[model samples]
Target: MKKPIKDQKMVIFILLSNVFTAFLGIGLIVPVMPSFKDVMELSGSTMGYLVAVYAVSQLIISPFAGRWVDRFGRKKMIILGLLVFSLSELIFGLGTHVSILYLSRILGGISAAFIMPAVTAYVADITTKEDRPKAMGYVSAAISTGFIIGPGIGGFIADYGIRMPFFFAAIISFLAAISSSLILKESLSHEEREQLSSNTTNFFKDLKKSIQPIYLIAFIMVFVLAFGLSAYETVFSLFSDEKFGFTPKDIASIVTISSIVAVIIQILLFGKLIDKLGEKRMIQLCLIIASVLAFVSTVITGFIAVLIVTCFIFLAFDLLRPALTTFLSKTAGNQQGFVAGMNSTYTSLGNFFGPALGGILFDFNIHYPYLFAGIVLIIGLGLTILWKEKSNEVSL
Candidate 1:
């Protein structure tokens, strides 16, 4: 029993590490973006398009990725995703043209579409219902920690060369893929995969069927929250650099510090807070907090003030994510892969529109993204009134 429990722990660690490396690759590019923009002679809208394209690819792939996770099995998809992530980073590091960077982003989105739902469903497979919130917290923390470290390291590494961090990210991701391929165990059985495949429909059909009375509102909230958050984040470094004359290192430091604080809070208090507040209540509160703070961000001036606000803003976004995941997972019985996939789908949709629109707005006014994000969150809060959780009766 002890050995089995220890093995489960090890598997969880490897799974979490995969998530960390994937996100780390994402963060690695952030601090270098301003430099990348200048070197490529790109405009603000082009920068936004670069970010939005990743989500666009993700939105397109998530439905198929979800069904594949259910049909194929988690371990295979996860390994494939890690490999794709490595390749995307390598391509981005090597690319000289803007078109190549866009291509890399498209591949990156495919990797995310594969990894996120698969890992999420993998975690659900391994953990018991009572233990899931804590496990989910660890999963969320790994993501935050990766984002925290990626920019900090990217900032310092940019001193070597702007492209160096992407190469580093590529190497680490490749190593992670190899490690997972050798050691990670498959969580789902053959019988389980067949069961899921028999029940699962194609992407469009599944999406159409998902709009029943039960979890529809929860899905909408996911989209709304993701849209608002992406709008704020997709333009963050650009926002800092343009508004306050912040350099890559300065932007990196602010993001790293803010994310560290959010990760610390997640590690220390996430499960306890969820138990006390419930997922729905916690999400609502975070939405309120984030919406207000997004507005405050536009008016604030000093670096210190911005850092303080950024920490709280990150804290809210970080908390809201797992809270919503927890809410959705509670009722999603055998359809963990399906549910996680839809979660990714809606998130990708919001991610797609948020940056696409936010980039245009950012060009018009540096503060417009934040203002727009705040408005989106306010609308999400209003929609939360419709979110009443129930047993998963409708199959996708």
Candidate 2:
């Protein structure tokens, strides 16, 4: 009895640690990727493809990953994901060729597909309705903390060598895998697994099911939100490098500062404000904020102007992510794994298109990616308004 109680306390901590490590690994690459592109003589479109391939891999695997989380239990998937993430990072660090980099990204995407649904479902399992907002706040904090630290470390470490950050990311992720294997316990029982397995469906079935009127609007919002953010973010380092002649360290400083501010706000305001305003309203507010900031990003000329616009953009994204997750979790009921998986799928789809398009836009004109991102957000906001108005009429 005491052991079960103890495991519950430790589980969230271990899960948060893994989340941090995963994001940290992702953030580390951002500061150095432009340098890698230059060294490889890669085109903007090629770089965008590199990012898109990861999302494509994840998109293909997400349905299966969702089912596996329910059938296989979350702990097993999390451990497997960490191991794969470590391997992918190691490969990326060692490989000199573009082909090797693509292979590494594919593996990384597969690992993300495994990890995200499992982790989210596990958290949903452990928390009650009232505690969920706070729980998600903690999750976002972990991610933001990783963003704060990863690039900071990567930027300074790149002085030693560009590949050093990848090697370091690999090492930390491997250690995290080992730690999780030892410390993390399964959140779902055998009986629970059997129950969930009985309700499982294939990828297309899940996709089709998600389009039912109950879920369609929310899922569309998720896709648009992800698309706009990814388009802007994927090109950001490249944009800074090209337009402003910024170094890796400069990019790292801007990101680190913004992440720190966002995390602080997330800690103080995210859960309480969500409780007060509700997810739908918060989502609307963030969409407006993000859309405006993205446009501002294109016009900004100096480091300070860029930093201010970037900070607000990051803040909007930070708040919007957990709000969307919380909204889905509230609606999911017994299908947490399924909903989480679909969420990842939609996000991957957005990520896939956003970066690919952003890269093409960047090649043609560096300002076009931000312009594209703003336009997508405005479209999303319009849809959100219409959806809500329709929903209210039905309720009436």
Candidate 3:
């Protein structure tokens, strides 16, 4: 029996809601974190470590989470992750000590490792190969939309207190959790489940098999892209603060504008581009464009120029994410959760390394982080070209 396309659409809608909720919770922290630094008397290195610890936990846990999702079920894992995320947000909102905040971030990372990859695998399960990129684009758009609203609201609340943003984030996440619990259905068919249950392959063996060269290349591309982007986030607000003497409110407005640009590109341009040009080509194009924009951002003097370049960076970054993920999903065969988990693991690696790199660069100079990111992006572009050529040869 054929699954109805309408049912698939409903699943995508629920997944999008999930993505939006999760990111809104994270985005609310971005603008507020710098303020926390001031209030808590935390150093730049301390801030970097605090953020990187989350990624470290995610990197360690993602492979296991992915296997569990494949073994258990996507709907179950997503619900569990959402519950964990909401609880973490609640803790984060209520905590006064930096140690508590650190614990919250670590817990949140564990939740994210489960939620993000499972969501991607679920999309792959429901979507046809032809329409996967379009589905992924919607996911990306949902994230950007959350980012657009989250920071704006967070910045407003930050004027009252840094903790207030976390409260709002927790509420949003809890609501999303309820929605998912009600609406999301299992994508795995009974026959497929039975086969998996009967065969009883070891999870680690399956994980190892999923880490093929193509998958590894895809993971590297994602890692590099994420690293560059995360480094930018670690330093961008500080740069604005130091270079332009911008307040938290002004930084929030700038990020809000970037988020709006990202949302537009993800929704309006990415799907068409991915369908027409193919995912590999789109990835290459985005990398080149982002690299150029990152370099330009460093050289530009005025706040307005920086803002314009930043818009381009956001556009490229946002478009690349879905394109890359779609490509990986298509290539991963039956190991969708494993592949997605590997992707998450790479992203976690980026998140961990990028901030530390950015902190070092920031200590030397404000522009160094962007400069380093551009260099890394250029390297990624080279790898992307090689990967594309190799992929074509394999397909032929």
TM-score to native of every candidate shown: 0.90, 0.89, 0.85
Clashing pairs in 1: none
Mind giving the per-residue lDDT tens digits that candidate 3 earns over 79-120? 888888888888988887889888888887787777876787
Cα displacement (angstroms), candidate 3, residue 52, comes to 2.1
Candidate 2 residues 1-396, lDDT tens each? 112223466777888888787656545666776899899898888888777788899888877888888899998999999899899889988999999999988888888788877877778778776665566657756855764467667877787889988788788888888988898778789999989889777778778878866667788888987788667767898999988999988988888888788878976898798988888888889999999988888778999998988888888888888887777766776665567667777888987898889988989998999998998888887877655422321110
Model 1, range 1-396, lDDT digits (tens) per residue? 112334488788888998888667555666787888788888877877877788889788877887898889999999999999989989999999999999998998899888877888788788876666667767767865775567778887788899988888788888988888898777878998999888776777658755776668788888987787667777888888878988888887888898888888976888899989888889999999999999999999989999999899889988888888878877676665556667767877887788789889988998988998998898889988877755646644
Off by over 4 Å in 2: 1-7, 125-133, 140-153, 189-195, 275-277, 333-335, 389-396
Clashes of 1: 0
lDDT of 2: 0.80
- Best-fitting candidate, measured by lDDT? 1
Model 3 alpha-carbon miss at residue 80, Å: 2.3
For each candidate, the alpha-carbon lDDT, in order, equals: 0.81, 0.80, 0.74
Against the true structure, candidate 1 has what lDDT? 0.81
Q: What are the candidates' C-alpha RMSDs? A: 2.7, 3.2, 3.4
